[model samples]
Target: MTDDYIYHVDGDLVPASEATVSVDDRGFRYGDAAFETLRAYGGTILAWDAHLERLERTCEALSLEHGLSAADLRGRIDETLAANDLADAYVRLSITRGVQPGKLTPQPDVEPTVVIYVKPLPRGGLEGDPVWDGPATVETVATRRVPDASIPAAAKTHNYLNGILARVELAADSDEALLCDLEGRIAEGATSNLCFVRDDVIHTPTTDGPVLPGITRDIVLELAREAGMPVREGRYEPADVLEADEAFLTNRTWELRPIATLDGRAIGGGPVTDRLAGLYDDRVENLCYE
Candidate 1:
């Protein structure tokens, strides 16, 4: 609740307290919205192109013809961040289907609602501390991921009930809930992507499954390969993760947080995890903190 911050709403900068979307908006009434969670480093939005690409993909998935280009959206984010004097921040950009008639079907003509908001965070790099207190405590939940057939796995939409329900099943002290697909194969966390190491090799769920092809996840894979570490992507069971030499979660915010335990069993934070984390930090330092 960044009450002191400024927010961009439909191209206008407004005080956070005044930022609002109408009740008639499809995004508010039916969750017809696409959003991106972005990380800003030294006032520069990290992977701006990649995040925009994914956001555009989500809008396409929702058929939400937001009449804004990447530059238009980026300007809004830049303006909001500047308005709040934010450099390192947790930023969010959303495009939703604007107010429409109360009907099940959507109309071809669209006037989308655009928004940008930010919350400051500690600097990220070799010289800065991590946002997390320590490695994450994770638990494998019974709530399975929604199949791609129902809702395309790649779409980062506002309809987060699936993730919310998964979180509802997490232990009170747990930091994350790991979700598996319908076939009982490991998928990903409610908000992050899961990665595990075994015998010096890294493995993650294939995007062909019910996994959200994460931007950070792809970047980590790139870093691992550049660091000469083995990487593989495929379906695996809970046993595979639990028995791994190490495990971790990745997202724009967390970056890379090693898993402390899975299902109350100790399982992560080894040499491999440390090395990959350092490599990730090095990239951030070179790209943003330099």
Candidate 2:
């Protein structure tokens, strides 16, 4: 709250303000970092193990050194929450390619800079009822999600310029932006994974395309399977999403949001979306309290 807590830098707990990395650090200069945003509830971190697994995957994909083991990182997060006196808040865990003075070459001697910050959850539509008030609208932006060839789309890396641009454009017109790949196939939203319901089947873009395998997205898929709904992942076009019976977006922050409209057409949330949204909420409740 007051920014007066300890952060896990290298292997020590340093003051929030004093936890600084060199300006020449590649992460500072070129956005060479990987991070995750976790939610805490009922004095416990939600989905701690899944979040850490994704973080570890990101670090491995980027070839960055994460000095702390999974247990060590979890301990630091627990300590940080206690130090800040926060039970229900958001945790930002970041690891960057450590300080380096030279160009793009990887510096093996520099240890990765790990930072954990706790902040109050932003109050907006996120806490409202699970059912969307109206049809969720989507805006097509000029920017496209990064192609797999450029950077593996599955990893949650610091390179987010494309997503930032899409978000800016969407904020001006609609609640979220729908992104397409270079080939014009619907990739995903700026920050969340896209899911559509048609004929009681749930469909999402495949990892082979330009889409982040969101933690929340994975949960929804599991929930759908447990509920006996057919779910598949494959290439889909914006038109396909528009024509679906129901559509929604999923992410850690939003959980599951029903889509009401695409472009200007009215597309109400389908029974599948509604049921899945409820199921996802129940999962969250259990994770937060259990």
Candidate 3:
């Protein structure tokens, strides 16, 4: 039997394959949308409030209205899980400026499109004890992130061409692509936040740059500090990152992934990264939904 999953689009809950939005959808036509990626542990969503809050802020930044209430969206997420019989899953929630005609400008009465998809997290680790598949190799691509002055990085817009291009240019052996900001400083990974270990200190690029302030990034910083690891945030050059003793990337999914190589040059193993990963796991198990 085929295991069919359910998805929610606008106010309709239907089979995943059948869910569709209009071709005129601004998200489809001009990438006018905001989104959030969240994971549910067991039946509870981790950082639901934070994700929802960001979603709201992003929509606001784009002048798109979030017509649904937070409680309403939460209930819909619960329903999606139940319909699909999923206790642990990855969910992508997107809100778009609804169908606009063949025009560049949105109308005054444009409705919003809400879409959420729930899928099994195939590579996701267990609830309490998550495991990584060893260190990953990341390469710096020529594509640079759009500076904050050009487009607000804080808005998780549907415009991911920059990230897509970086991934396209990634080396065949690389697991991810490291992107630079307009200033040639280390910005972040195509899809994750960048962090490095040097002299027993944890360093990450300041969000004052074009980096997206990720929820997991924030949690990792707090966990690192509590574990007595000195955490520093600033603008970092490629040489600094390449010469670092060790480095890792973080995002809502993937959580913590240590970097084995930068442009195929070996970066040594990090005991501090190991310690922080363990602490992050503890925090996920006990403090995730709390």
Best by lDDT: 1
Least well predicted 10-residue stretch by lDDT in candidate 3: 122-131
Q: Which candidate number has the best TM-score?
A: 1
Of 1 and 2, the candidate ranking higher by lDDT: 1
Q: Which stretches of candidate 1 lie above 4 Å from their native place?
A: 1-3
List of clashing residue pairs for candidate 1: none
lDDT of 1 by residue, 88-143 (tens): 99999888888899996998899999888899899987876788999999988989
Q: Which lDDT tens digits does candidate 2 get at residues 1-290?
A: 56576666666667788887778767788888999988776567767888988888888888887677888788878887777777766788888987777788787765778778876553222243432345567776778888889888878987888888888876554888889999999999887788988888889999888788888899899989988899999998888887898888887767788777778877767688878877766776666655
Please list all clashing residue pairs in model 3, or write none if there are none.
Answer: none
Worst 10 residues of 1 by lDDT: 1-10
TM-score-best of 1 and 2: 1
lDDT tens per residue, model 3, 1-290: 14668998888899977888999899999999999999887777878888988888898888886577998889888888888888767888888888878898777675889888888754333244343466778999899999898889888999999999999997677789999998899999999999998888899999999999999898889988877779999999999988898898898878888888998788855888888777777666665444
Q: How displaced is residue 261 in candidate 1, in Å? A: 0.7
Clashes of each: 0, 2, 0
Provide TM-scores for the models: 0.98, 0.88, 0.94
Q: lDDT, candidate 2, residue 254?
A: 70
Cα-based lDDT at residue 259, candidate 2: 76
Q: Alpha carbon lDDT of residue 31, candidate 3?
A: 95
